[model samples]
Target chain A: EAGVVQSPRYKIIEKKQPVAFWCNPISGHNTLYWYRQNLGQGPELLIRYENEEAVDDSQLPKDRFSAERLKGVDSTLKIQPAELGDSAVYLCASSGGFGETQYFGPGTRLLVL
Target chain B: QQQVKQSPQSLIVQKGGISIINCAYENTAFDYFPWYQQFPGKGPALLIAIRPDVSEKKEGRFTISFNKSAKQFSLHIMDSQPGDSATYFCAASVGGYNKLIFGAGTRLAVHP
Candidate 1:
C-alpha cells in the first residue's frame, strides 16, 4: 500500500513570509495528524483530525499557525508571517483508527530565515 | 508537564554489542506504547510496539520491555549494526485518542 504523501519536501522562506505544507493521507485512514520536529527533538503534534473535524489543536499557535482537513483526506498546514523559530520538519501521518500504528510521510523541511 | 520522558540524548555502540534506550511515562492512562526510528532527512517509521498487558515483546533483533508498576519501558537492539543508526522515539497514548505523547528521542550511533 502507498504511504502518506506530502508535497514540497523542502521549503525556504524569509521571516514574515507565509508558508504552507500539504499532506495526502493513506486511503481509508480515518485519522490524520500534523507534527513539527525541531532539531534533536521528537515530533510534537500540531493538530489532529478525525475525518474533517479537528479534535485536538490546542497545541497549535493560533496567532500564526492554522490547519484544515478539507475533505477528511487531504490536509494543509499554514504559517502566516512565519518566524525564524518556525524552522522545522513538518511531518504528516495517518492511521486506520485511533490507537493504531501511524504511517508517516516524507515530511516537509521548512527553513525560515 | 511532559508525559513521556526518554533518556540518553545520544548513544554510541559498537557492532555486535547491545544498545538500549529507556523511557518513562507519568500517565497511567497511557495503555499503548510504540517506538519509531527515523533516519536523517526522513520521516519516522514504526519499529515495534507493545501494549501494557505484555511485559515484553520481541521482533527480530528488536525487543520492547515494559514495567507497568514503574511506568517505564525500554528498547533493546541486539547485535547492533551500523545500519541501525538513527533517532529513536518512544511514544504513549490512550486507547481512544490518536494523539501520541512522544519522548525527546535518543540518537543511536552504531559503529562498525
Candidate 2:
C-alpha cells in the first residue's frame, strides 16, 4: 500500500505571508496528524483528526495556525502571517486505527525570510 | 512530565561496530515506547518498539533494551553499516497510539 503523501516538498515565503501545506493519508486510515519539526529536534504534534473530527488539537496555535480534515482522508495546515520561527518542516501522518503505528509523509519544508 | 530525554546529540561509529542511543522519560503513564529512523528528505519510520512488560526486544540488527524501573530505554545497532546512518528519535505515549512525546533525537553516522 502507498504511504502518506504530502505536497510541495519544499516552500519558501516571506515573513507575514500566508502558507499552506497539504497531506493525503494512507488508504483506509482513520487517524491523521499534523506535526512541526524544527532543526535538530523531533517532530511536535500540532493537530489530530479521527474520521473528520478533530479529536485532539490542544497543541495547535489557534491565533495563527489552522488545520482542516474535511472528509478524513486528506488534511490541510495553514499558517497566516507566517513568522520566522514558523520556518520548519510540516509533517503529516496517518494510522489504520487506534493504537496502530502511524506512518508519516516526507513532509513540506518551509522557509520564511 | 511529558519529556523524553535522549543523549548524545550526535554519534560516530565505524562499520561492523556497535551504535547505541539512549532515552529516558519521567511520565509513568506512558506505556508504549517506540523508536523511529529517518534519512535526509524522508519522514520517520518505526524501527523497533518495546513495552514496559518486556525487558528486551530485538529485530535482526536492531535491539531495544528497556529499563522500566529506571524509566530509560536504549537502542542498539549490531554491526552498524554506513547505510544505517540516520537520525533516530525515541518517543512515548500514554495508553496507546495517541499523541507521542518525542525526544530531541540523535544523529548517527557510520563510517565505512
Candidate 3:
C-alpha cells in the first residue's frame, strides 16, 4: 500500500510571499492531519480532517494559515505573507479511523527567508 | 502547555547495549502512549505504543514500559545497533487517533 504523499519535498520562499503545500493521504484513510515540525522538536498538529470536515483546528493560525481537505482524500495547507518563523517541515499523515495508527508522508521542508 | 516531558536530550549507546528513553505526562486522561522514530530528513515513523492497562509491551527489539500510577513511560531498545540511531519522540493522546501531545524528543546515537 502506498503511504501518504506530499508534494515539493523542499520549498524556499521570501518573507511576505505566499506558500502552499499539498498532500495526498493513503487509500481508504478516513482521517488526515497536517502538522508543522520545527528544528529539534516534534511535529505539532495544525489541522485535522475527518472525511472532509475539519474536526480539530484549534492550533491552526487562522489569520495567516488556512487548510482545506476537499473530498477527504487530498489536502492543502497555505500560508500567506510568510514569516521567517514559518520556516519548518510540513508533514501530512493519514489514518483509517480516528483512533488508528497514523502513517506519515515524507513532508515538505519550507524555508522562508 | 507542555503535557509530556522527556529526559536525556541526547544519548550515546554502544552496539549490543541497551538504549532507554523516558517520558512523563501530566494528563491522567491520556490513555495511549506511542513512540516515534525519525531520521534526519524523513518524517517520524511509529515505533511502539502502549495503553495504561499494560505495564509492558514488547515488539521484537523494542519494548514500552508503562507505569500508570506514575504517568510515565519508557522505550527500551535491546541489542541496539547503529541503525537505531535516530531522534525518538514520545507522545500521548486521550485516545488512539486523537490529537497527540509530544515530548521534546531524544536523539540517540548508537555507535558500532
Candidate 4:
C-alpha cells in the first residue's frame, strides 16, 4: 500500500508571509499527525487527529499555527506570518488506529528568510 | 519528566561491526518505547519497538534491550552495514498512541 503523502517537498518563503502544508494519509488510516522537526533534532508533535476530531493539539502554537483535517483523510497545517524561526521540516504521518505504528511521508522542508 | 535523553550525538562503526544506541527516560509511566531511523531529506521510519513487559526483543539484525528498573533502553544493530547509516531516535509514550517524547537522536555512520 502507498505510504503517507505530503505536498511541496520543499518550500521557501520570506518572513511574515503565510505558508501552508498539505498531507494525505495512507488508505484506511484513521489517525493522522503533524510534526515539526528542527535541524539535529527529532520530530516534535504539533497536532494529532483521530478521524475528524483533534485529540491532541496542546503543543501547537495557536497564535500563528493552525491545522485541520476536514474529511479525516487529508490534513493541512498553516502558519500565518511565518517567522524566521519557523524554518524546519514539517512531517505528516498516519496510522491504522490509535496505538498503531505510524507511517510517515517525505515531509515538506520550509525555509523562511 | 517529559524528556527522553539519548547519548552519543554521533557514532561511527565499521561494516560487520556492532552499532549500539542508548536512551533513558524519567517518566516511569512510559510503557512503550520505539526507535526510528531517518535518512537525509526523508521522514523517520519505525525501526523497532519494545514494551516494558519484555526485557528484550529482536528482529532480524535489530535488537531492543529494555531495562525497566533503570528506565533505559538501547538499540543494537548486529553486523552493521553501510546502509544502516542514518539518524536514529528513541521515543517513549505512556498508554500507547499518546504524546511521544523523543530523544535528541544519534547519527550513526557505518563505514564500509
Off by over 4 Å in 4: none
A1-113: candidate 1 lDDT, tens digit per residue: 88899989999999999999999999999899999999888899999899999999999999999999997889999999999999999999998977778989999999999
Which residue pairs overlap in candidate 2's backbone?
none
Off by over 4 Å in 2: none
- Candidate 1, superposed: residue stretches over 4 Å from native: none
Per-prediction DockQ, in order? 0.72, 0.91, 0.88, 0.84
Candidate 3 stretches greater than 4 Å from native = none
Per residue, candidate 3 scores C-alpha lDDT tens digits across A1-113 of: 78899998999999999999999999999999999999888899999999999999999999999999888789999999899999999999999998999989999999999
Write the number of the candidate with greater lDDT, choosing between 1 and 4.
Answer: 4
Residue B46 alpha-carbon offset, candidate 1, angstroms: 0.9
lDDT digits (tens) for residues B65-106 of candidate 4: 999999899999999999999999999998786678889999
TM-score of 4: 0.98
Fraction of the true interface contacts (Cα pairs closer than 8 Å across chains) found in each model: 0.79, 0.91, 0.88, 0.84
User: What TM-score goes with each of the models?
Assistant: 0.96, 0.99, 0.98, 0.98
Weakest lDDT window of 10 consecutive positions for candidate 2 chain B? B93-102
Per-residue lDDT tens digits for candidate 3, residues B2-82, read 489997899999999999999998888888999999998788999999988889999999999999888889999999999
lDDT of 2 at A64: 99
Model 4 is docked with a DockQ of 0.84
Note the chain A TM-score of all models in turn: 0.98, 0.98, 0.98, 0.99
| DockQ of model 3, rounded to 2 decimals | 0.88
Note the residue pairs that clash in candidate 4: none
lDDT of 2 by residue, A27-86 (tens): 999999999999999999999999999989999999999999987788999999899999
